[model samples]
Target: MSRQKTESEVARTTGRLGPAERADNWRRLGSEEFDVVVIGGGVTGAGTALDAATRGLRVALVEARDLASGTSSRSSKLFHGGLRYLEQLEFSLVREALRERELMLTRLAPHLVKPVSFLYPLTHRFWERPYTAAGLFLYDTMGGARSVPGQKHLSRAGALRMVPALKRNALIGGIRYYDAQADDARHTMTVARTAARYGAVVMNSSQVTGFLREADRIAGVRVRDVETGEETEVRAQAVINATGVWTDELQRLSGGRGRFRVRASKGVHIVVPRDRIVAESGMILRTEKSVLFVIPWGNHWIVGTTDTDWNLDLAHPAATKADIDYILEHVNTVLATPLKHDDIEGVYAGLRPLLAGESEETSKLSREHAVARVAPGLVAIAGGKYTTYRVMAADAVDAISGDVAGRMAPSITDRVPLLGADGYHALVNQADQLAAEHGLHPYRIRHLLDRYGSEIHDVLALGDERPELLKPIPAAPNYLQAEVAYACSHEGALHLEDVLTRRTRISIEYAHRGIDCAEPVARLMAEVLGWDDARVAREIEVYTQRVDAERDSQLQPDDQAADAKRSAAPEAREKLTEPIS
Candidate 1:
């Protein structure tokens, strides 16, 4: 005979990542011997941890900074087959990514990943349609079965109806196709939390200083808590490095040259109000360099991506005036109303970890990933795009088979839905009831359902005692006060930057860029983390300086000047140091 679970019990059993959980995981890290230890808290690392844990392996994961703090959070936020890659004739890469996209849409993470449509504006008149149709045909069928709609061809007038913001001369016709997109930071953190639910010890703000070696073979890692400078040795039979752009840097710490090298390709994006572009669907246009995207974000349009090589400052890849100008110049050619600098609300830059090749152009590099056993017990995986993270993770863990003691199970992450995935559709169906119960609008309830899924109950439970938390933030009304508290209580947010930048995306969505609400957000976090008044003030000051530095960097003309300006801000994790050999 079983009893029904209380609301509090349900929240407790769902793997809350609070401060107590971190303290317990730290003790286990110092005390236990594991089958595998993964470094890097990006999507691949989080995915690798989930893959390892579900296979019944004892596993632990550690990140130097906040999860997705580096490249993962600063992405184009799409999970689709790289349509541009088809022009490069990378068929297998497209097929693999499409399959992953279908899985995320239909079976796994249905809450986080949603189907989005894009219009490929046809500049050429006659031959271009058939040529593009041929490519689209291959794209639609290559993924086997999909949940999204197939391609539809439209006349020039039809295209204008779909996107009235487009210039009359921009295209003769257009083709609309379906893809998927998600909040990348939220998805990556959910992957990590799902790993924790499956019994993988996970912690952020912990850096790998040096490799632990047993004679010639690698044994484990020496981890330092970047917040407190506490050191621990997490022993493991195998170690996997899934660091993206920093792959080579982490490989060097192992004192071994990796099987291949990784080069950093910088990509920059800018955000503007959604009303600036009067479109029913997103647009994809061609450039001499690469494809330009006008992605539809909530109340905003995300336009971007200049692909150029970047060598300086892997941690904070800065966007210069040239990069922003390049994007605006290309996108403005197609828009009816040209976008200027003043229309821009936010800017961000991220690096793609491409496998070093003979070509000097970063856009020419392969999108396929590579996994190699760099040392006896060490494996390194790099050079993959965001959509195919699960495949990259599986290949990485499979590379370390010999290091583990017993026969390891094959990767089961494809069948494993993320933490908030289950029961999401059912809750979405109950949005009206939820809104009535919580005294919120149905739109707000639907938003919470998308972000939290079935775990919306856990998030709402935080407001039970303090109903004031249910109200929206004064400046950033898109987010609730409960969400900020939930960042620390259930998402392992350590500092103010983690909440504004990655956890909730308040930084990039608003014109003030999280500066106006930094103190209020910090105060909300302090309630859960037990911070003093001085500590709250310090968090606000650090976050404000970061926003100021980013604004200053965007005015710089070149990468060197932009990097210097951006790097001047104090790191949130003050004790974090360079990787020691």
Candidate 2:
């Protein structure tokens, strides 16, 4: 019988199939060719891997770093149809995105994605309100907007009543529209895990050093185990390049004429205390080239993102001074009480892998993606928004149908619920009873459900066994100690950063940046990963330096100056030994 995959089963499988297993498998790749080998474990790559595997293809997905470590995780956390795309007359894009959004919320990832309301404040007296209202009316009638509440128009007095933080003068009136929000990092990781569950041999920290070729035809790849610095050849029938901004680098490694240029646009976001921005719904403000969103995260407000062209380090893009200033200036215009540098609790920067169209403005460049068969055995897909990743993956997989030689199943991802999605509503209904049994407040259980969905029982499993793990973490009380331990043991979190930054939001949610809780969290992780005191200290030090560098960058005068400062910080050191071939 195929064994049911439990939490422990998942952990054991991942630990056993780490870097060493990666190397051994790579060495045998050419001898036992995979049906498809996917490079880049971002959302698109992960989604693509799942699509191919579900269709009965033998697939292997490799990433140089963590999954969703790139643009996928750094989004505005919205699964939205670009309402602004309508202004540019991109009706088709918005309709498709809206349909996908509806699918995700109602059927696919119901556990992870939820509806969020946004207030579009009209500034001008006469023309703007009617204009904005007409657009929103269209938005409501479009594909799946009906899944959410329809638009609500409010007068200036009514607008201020809804969003008391806004100055009365800022808006002539307002219109509320519906969209969906997601935990981007969590969703991306779940996508990768879903792909793994479907039989994709998903491995991270396995870097592709070069492409494998059989004469003129491209074949597979020469991959390095980033942990051990060992290399092996992973041969496949067809390879897909979904490396986002690293597409050019992958092409150079492949030694081919690269298909299309990918230009990186840097977007920076600042997080402040929730009390600072008093709004019932999120706000969207227009900018010169793009738009800025003051999105509400739990207990915090996320105000960002300045969009400008970037030519900096792809792995860790730094927010320049200009980026920060631009955001502050635009946001300040609408706020009754302005936010200063110290008022900011956290800052983050991400790069958008936009297809470098001939347009001078990056914002005007199409968000639509392109899939190109660059070589006989290779295909590369790039340039799309996160909301439409599934469609993009399906398209990329469809491109390789000729080479696969078998009748393949249609894309089932739209119908395949993520791991936690099934039975989520039923679990939600029983959360109160579960919370009382577990000695947690009902709110806590609800919180766990939102983050873990039905898999919350797995998290609670550790607590049930060890009552001590049920207590709140010392410095970061929002998280339970069991959560910290679970991340390392189950989520492939090798280092403290992975646990703090990705697995949990302590790095961004707290002003201390988890410094006070680092050692305790490290200790909790140590029990599972076998880290000693010295190792724990080193991890803490590395994380502290990273936080310090980010803080220093935020103080710089402009993007150039901020990037220089941020880049001065040491590069991330390897935590595990590279694989041995």
Question: Tens digits of per-residue lDDT for model 2 on 38-105?
Answer: 99888899889888988888888888877777887787889998899999898999999999999989
CA shift of 462, model 1, Å? 1.6
- What is the Cα-based lDDT of residue 62 in candidate 1? 94
Q: What is the lDDT of residue 526 in candidate 2?
A: 85
Question: Candidate 2: misplaced stretches above 4 Å?
Answer: 1-32, 573-581
- Residue 74 in candidate 1, Cα distance off native in Å: 0.9
Candidate No. with top lDDT: 1
TM-score of the candidate numbered 1? 0.97
Instruction: List model 1 lDDT by residue over 167-266, tens digit each.
Output: 9999999999989899999999999988888888888999999999999999999999988899999999999998888889999988999999999999
Position 363, candidate 1: lDDT: 83
